[model samples]
Target chain A: MSVTTRRRFAAVALASVAVLAVTTACGDDGDEGGSDGGQITLTVDVFGEQGFGYEKLYEQYMKDHPNIKIEERGKGMGLGDYNTRLTQWMASGAGAGDIVALEEGTIVQFKAQKQNFVNLADHGAASLESNFLPWKWNDGKAGDQILGLGTDVGSMAICYRKDLFEKAGLPTEREAVAAQWPTWDAFIETGKKFQAKSGKVKFVDAATNTFNSILMQTAGNGTGYTYYDKSDQFVLSSNPDVKSAWDLTVKAIEAKLSAGLQTFSDPWATGFKQDQFAIVTCPAWMTGVIKGNAGDAAAGKWDIAKAPGNGGNWGGSFLSVPKQSKHPKEAAELAKFLTTPEAQLEAFKALGNLPSSPKALEDPTLLASKNDYFSNAPAGEIFGAGAKDFKPVYLGPKNQAVRDAVENALRSIEQGQRKPAEAWDDALKAGEAASK
Target chain B: MTTNTADRTRRGRPAHHAQPPRPRKARGNFGTRLDLKTSPYLYVAPFFVIFLIFQLYPLVYTFWVSLHNQPLGGEGEFVGADNFTALMKDEQFWNSVYNTLGIFVVSTIPQLLIGLYLANALNRKLRGRGFFRMTMAVPIITSTAAVAIIFGQLYNRDFGLANWVLGWFGVESIDWRATKWASWIAISTMVDWRWTGYNTLIYLASMQSIPKDLYESAALDGASARRQFWQITVPMLRPTIIFTVIISTIGGLQLFAEPLMFSSGSGNYTGGTLRQYQTVTMYLFENMFTRFNLGYAATVAWALFLLIVIVAFINYLLTRRIGSAK
Candidate 1:
């Protein structure tokens, strides 16, 4: 063979290999799926435990439709890492799962980038809107487009140690406990009383939680200032509610009411097991975490009470189908199915995640159910009542950033590194800066 | 083989040069003959191709992104030099720079000193020499993430073994994460623990290469082991020390995982509540992912690159100066 011909052939072969590799690495854009062979695979990506009986629901769904294969990728890391990974995937326009979980704090940010997600309303998502909480349904909507399906709502409650309350000569009854702290100031007063009687035990787990609960309760109230106004201008520095929450949290820290443990830390978990704190600012999902950490030794030692002041929402998540998914229809179907009233109820019963579906919230079976872990606390009713009082707060695009800044400021106070006024100023400055 | 001789003959070889005739075999297939000159280029092309696509492309793209008001997953507006100006005024950027330098000094100094000492000790003939050397490398093989996690637990203010030990001396528990210096010390402990052994191994290899004759002469002249280490070992190991210093400076400037994991795992990327331990890379990661400020993150990346280059150059000059003085 001529040298030039051999050289040309070699170059062509190398080029073809490179091209093949590039194409394969980019992945298959399977725009269509066939039901003829009764086979389709769906991948779902979630952070932490989907705790929502998703595995069981997926199993049930796959059994009913034997042709469909479902693969779930549980990141197990917390929400921050999960959101970061999802954002990277979305930006790169590849390697995204068919369905992804979006936490409420980050949902607004994702909603702003509407091009990355499929408008679920185009695929009959609107028809199921009536099935979910109105606010939750709206949260998943960006204008007319429904970007996600509501999965769970994190209605806030207070889980207190009944034995510890008795030890401190405070009321042990759930109703009496709830009435003692009708306002945040009353709660702090109760904490002081408890502290004077009880030796070293703290009234609350962390001041940061107090800050978040109070902020969520007051941010969307009639006040004109919240994280942002209607025009999306940052109002953190001017927000009266933010100032109040920060001040109250600072008071709690100074009064030594907080145990100063960062939530979900190993020490925090240890605090639960050891009963180091009297009360935990319990979001609906936090019940699972509490129960998991408290173990069998602490069973029936804890009880549920109403959160101080007006009710607030702490956490919740939505299932979003990315536009990059090859099986968009199937993915949408799975997302809708996972969030259905029955599925949501099952999840609530199996995991502690509160149901976002209004119908599921009203289910007699769920309401009648009691948890042995919390002295037979009617968790469903407590969370349901909390859920009812939860108003839909408009979370700005930088909501997580603002929240994190404030939380860090609260942490500094809890650590005794900064005074309330100084930390408050720092927090406001950081929050405003982050908003920009 | 036959083609090379044939080509040489066709090109007219020097008359004085003697050549052996090679017999040509029947060409059965196109694959049988190989182009030796061009084949080496083909063999080494894959690494360069992959490097260009994966490394160089992203680097150039990052520089381009730095010049714009890039938001994640969105088209960026052209805003040349604006991001850089904003970064200059950003207190968090300066804080990160300070924290990174603080941690780099705290970690690298102790690490190099202890590493040098350990290498010197290991160089001595002793019982279980192989075992001791192998054990020294155990921390190096352990994953950085795991090391960070274990160190985090150990540094816990309330429950850690460190505070537990301190309790024996009537010392109150130090809030490692809250205090600026304490947090740096905690993070430095993590960085030092993970890397000291690796540096020890490097120093050990360099120390082993140093002529035994120099050490013997020092010993014969009544010089102590310590003096030998100072006078002969250190000077002899200058180039290796320089290499490790350069590598450590680059690694320290890019310190991310230790501080990230140390500060409550993945949730708190600011490194601490006060960002007392936030490294430059952590700051870059925070802007890129948490804040979704891609342009700012790119700017931080460029700044870090510049810092590393400047520090490495300073190190090169210092090493050269020392070498020349000797």
Candidate 2:
């Protein structure tokens, strides 16, 4: 080949590769929606064990709206990873799905950046307020702008191993177990008694998880807020409910009832298989996680009982449409559909995520439903009852960070690395630092 | 820059001299001259273009964002130097720095020593030397997540191979994630497992290049194998040793994965219950991902970059003194 020809060919190859790279990096555009052959794809971002249990709903929605295709992402993903990615996408003004699921803790953080979301109140959501629980509907709103529609409510319960409870000479039936612990003090006494008879099996999975459940329950019933008040003040040091919950958790740790495992960790998962801990703080959403982690062998060995204190929420999520979505109208419609009373009942059957809708909670089908995994403990009725009594709690923008600080402090005590007093002081300081 | 010029000169002669027998059809043509000047740049443009877009842009942008109070999904206020000033006094930031250095020292020292000994042993005539050399690469080829997961199991508090072995010696099982030193040591071992073989291979390759006659003459002069290893092999592999040392310094100071995976649990960016083994990079991620403090995370990133540069420079100085001490 001629030198010029060879050089030209080489230059052309390099230029093409560069062009290919630039083109590939840009990838597909999000703007293409419902234009080509009247078909469009809607991406839904969700997290946790089974991703909102929306498979049947998605299939039904697509069959109804033939022009729209529904695709869900983030199945089997942890909330932490999902939130981190969602935060990046929100900040960058792109890359987020058309409809994104936000956990209760996450929604509080996103409430500070409410402009990124398409206010659902503008899209007929305000008219549908009576369809949901009062607090559930209000929690979706920032002032008058509604950012999301409530999907599920993580009502509190206590799931204990029936075999272990029987071995420990405690009541194995759900109603009898509920009668054993009517208050936090009674719960601790039960834990101590269980510990005395149960060898190599602790009362609870981790002090931190149980502490958070108690804190949520206490803060919900008493103050109706957590680390922050309605005005978003840092109240960790001043909140009487927080200190009482802390003291109650400290009492459990002092009684040596904790298994010293971090929830959702690998060791914690292993603990389920080996029956290392007799009980775990079970929110309505956690039943799915427990079923998956405990495997088929532990079926019928677990049962859900009433939580010791008043109803509180530890999790649950909202569905929001980002402003960056190319088809916010369609996204809002889909989100609204997924959160309807009928759709929520379908999800309740698929996963134990309790319906946030008051009508759905009162549905005869939902009330009759049983979780075969939990020994047919009337999972629907139990979670439904808890949801009815749960009061909404206000969380601040920096709630997760501050909560992490408290969880770390609790883990420190669980590891036997810090005194309760020292840990409490550090938790306050760390929480303050984290909020900054 | 000088090497590029020298390389052009050296490469320029081969084409010119080798092509002298052929007719120079476009020797004096303008297009040919322009092609000669620009085509070389075109060939190398992709690397520089990629570097500019990915590496240099992010670096400059990081410094710019470090000055602001940037949260996710919001415009940042330019509070110049406030982030840096706060970072200077921040105990968690300082703790991360201290942990980074502690892990770097604890891992790199034993890593290099073991690497040297392994390289020295592999340099000798042994059966199945090719197999042994290839075996050293297995850990490097293994996915980081797989390595982290396996090591996570090994260091687990309740049931782990490490604590199980310790039990044979009548020692109590250690909660690897509890204390600062225990977590650091566990993470350091993970680092060593992955990188020691890499350093060993580098040393082995460099050692093979050294003249074998020096070792033969040393043997004739009544020098033992240990003495020859220290005096002869050590001095000859100074540049390679320094190279490995500098590389390890950079890797160690920016430690993230080992410490991160070592602390299991959802949202576990703190490294431990008390930030015991939280390195600078992990702290950066905690700020960026967990806390959503974009400005603070950028500041942490810049600090980590400066730290790696400073530590790598110090490594250069210390490793340069190795053979010269003779």
Query: Could you say which candidate leads in TM-score?
Result: 2
Best by lDDT: 2
Task: Kindly report which residue stretches of model 1 are placed more than 4 angstroms away from their true locations once superposed.
Answer: A1-34, B1-36, B265-267
TM-score of chain A by itself in each prediction: 0.90, 0.92
lDDT of 1 at A101: 88
What ranges in model 2 sit over 4 Å off? Answer: A1-37, B1-28
Q: Against the unseen true structure, what C-alpha lDDT does each candidate score?
A: 0.85, 0.90
RMSD of each: 7.0, 5.7
Residues B139-180 of candidate 2 have per-residue lDDT tens digits of 899887888899999988898899999999999999999998
Model 1 pairs whose backbones collide:
none
Residue A318 in model 2: shift from native, Å?
0.5
lDDT of 2: 0.90
- The alpha-carbon lDDT assigned to residue B306 of candidate 2 equals 91
DockQ (Cα-based) for each candidate = 0.42, 0.60
